[model samples]
Target: MARRRNPFDIFSDFEEMFEEMLREFEKMGPGEHISGPFFYGFSINQRPGEEPEIREFGNIRPERGRIEIGERKPLVDVFDTDKTVQIVAEMPGIEKEDVELNVEGRELEIKASRGDRKYHEFVELPADVDIDTARASYKNGVLDITLNKVEKNKGRKRINVE
Candidate 1:
């Protein structure tokens, strides 16, 4: 007979794995210093008929008992609608003035910096958006953005043959 597993076991397993990794990271040689402001996190997406999607974002990477740090990639979610595209990002401890956004064609770039915390991410939009119709708001560590989709030309242009 097969044994059933508890759903809460997932968190315990993840905690144990994280602790083991931290222990391994601490085995570095003397004079090797690990700097602060390191961050690592992951998000899980579950759908009714699809496999779970796991995404990792952070500036710090744990490799061979060493850590490498860079610009943090903020966790983001994009929703495409018939008339618009919405983007939401989580960036805590940052003021609204510190954030910057740039849109080009079907791409969007987000960047922010505050003290020791910095974030940067480039997202490929699902459709072309009207740059002049963008609206953004930030409150309580969450940034919300909406842009109108550019309408496609339905009529084909005729070319004269030589």
Candidate 2:
């Protein structure tokens, strides 16, 4: 019989690898400072009849045996309804005034930065939304946005060329 593999083993392996990388950083000269506000996380979503979706968020990335830090991508969820589209994002330790949003057609860009925390995410809306009707609220590290969906064209329009 074949041996059964343990799912949690991967997490332990990841921790060991991460520690090794940190030790490599310690090898730098004493004058070098290794400070960090690093963030890394992931989310798994499984719908009723669809394949599981895995999403990675945060500012940490391993490239060519080195860790790269950049703007964190907050975990976001988009809900589409017949009349509206709602989006929720998790952005901790950020103020409402620091958040900036831009919407054009079916795309929405969210950006926020304060002190050492910075977040940026581009969301592709499921349907057309009325930019003027968008509403947003933030509280306790969560940002919620809602937009009214544009009505679909009833029928095809005939265009005449001169």
Candidate 3:
């Protein structure tokens, strides 16, 4: 009778183990990777030079898919008139001094960061706007932003004469 090899011996070359897994998956079927249920996402945009967080391939619990992470949820409200576009965003725990607003052409950029929490979002205006004329005021845990939209070029009115 042949003696069973120790599992520790199989894991000696950890990196090479992934190749064996790939071969096994290929032999099963192309549908095997996505079909069996358990899945994890890999994001390349994580902080540079930081190793990704990996969880051991353990008991499969589909219920874990419901977990959500990241910064706190943000609330934004935008309204505009002929003269100006107004935006009010509610971001608690963020101070007015921490908020910075920038306008380039018709895009309004709001960046506010405090500690590990940050809120960054861009809003496109109805048309071009003057960045210099735009104003920002943050108070009462709400950011008030106003942008003076650029004046529309006057279109010639056509009239048919008989």
Candidate 4:
């Protein structure tokens, strides 16, 4: 003789599993927008013996009437010429008064918040610069920052290791 399984028992097991899955998804938080299994508009590249690198191209949620959860990091590019360092950043839908910039040592920090959008980013400069001499301008949702390089002798100190 063989043992028989009840169909109702099998259905009950499936229902429990589905409910568990839903509970886990709810933990991600209410009003959390996710387009798919992975964050939309992002790509990942994996190489042998190396960690995966993720790059985000844009936001997938509807641009209008979307509520963001936390601070977003804006895309920025830093470059240097012979005498100056330049930083260009894209911050859409932000006003001039909503943006704040700070430079300490070789690090540059940018923060902006307006309406329902927030952005923050930190950049390490290629060379030491005079923060007081930095000039910045924002127009049409873009920010351009320029800093003059400090003289090498004045920018570095020789520490006597005792």
- By summed lDDT, which 10 consecutive residues of candidate 3 come out lowest? 53-62
lDDT of 4: 0.72
Tens-digit lDDT track of model 4 for 79-160: 7888999999888889999999999999999999887677777888999999889999999999999999997655667899
Point to the candidate with the largest lDDT. Answer: 2
Which order, best to worst by TM-score?
2, 1, 4, 3
Q: Can you tell me which runs of candidate 4 are displaced by over 4 Å?
A: 1-69, 154-162
lDDT of 3: 0.61
Quick one: best TM-score, which candidate? 2
lDDT of 4 at 60: 28
Residue pairs whose backbone atoms clash in candidate 2? none
Query: Native-vs-model 1 lDDT?
Result: 0.83
Cα lDDT of model 2 overall?
Answer: 0.86
Each candidate's number of clashing pairs is 0, 0, 0, 0
TM-score of predicted model 3?
0.51
TM-score for each of the candidates: 0.73, 0.75, 0.51, 0.57
| TM-score of model 4 vs. true structure | 0.57
Q: Write the per-residue lDDT of candidate 1 for residues 58-108, one digit (tens) a residue.
A: 886555545567888899988889999999999898999999999988899
Candidate 2: tens digits of C-alpha lDDT, residues 1-162: 976668745355456547755866778798986466776777778789986666668887555677767889999998989999999999999999999999987899999999989999999999999998889999999999999999988899998999
Local lDDT at 44 for model 1: 80
TM-score of 2: 0.75
**Which regions of candidate 3 are displaced past 4 Å?**
1-68, 155-162
State which candidate, 1 or 4, has the greater TM-score.
1
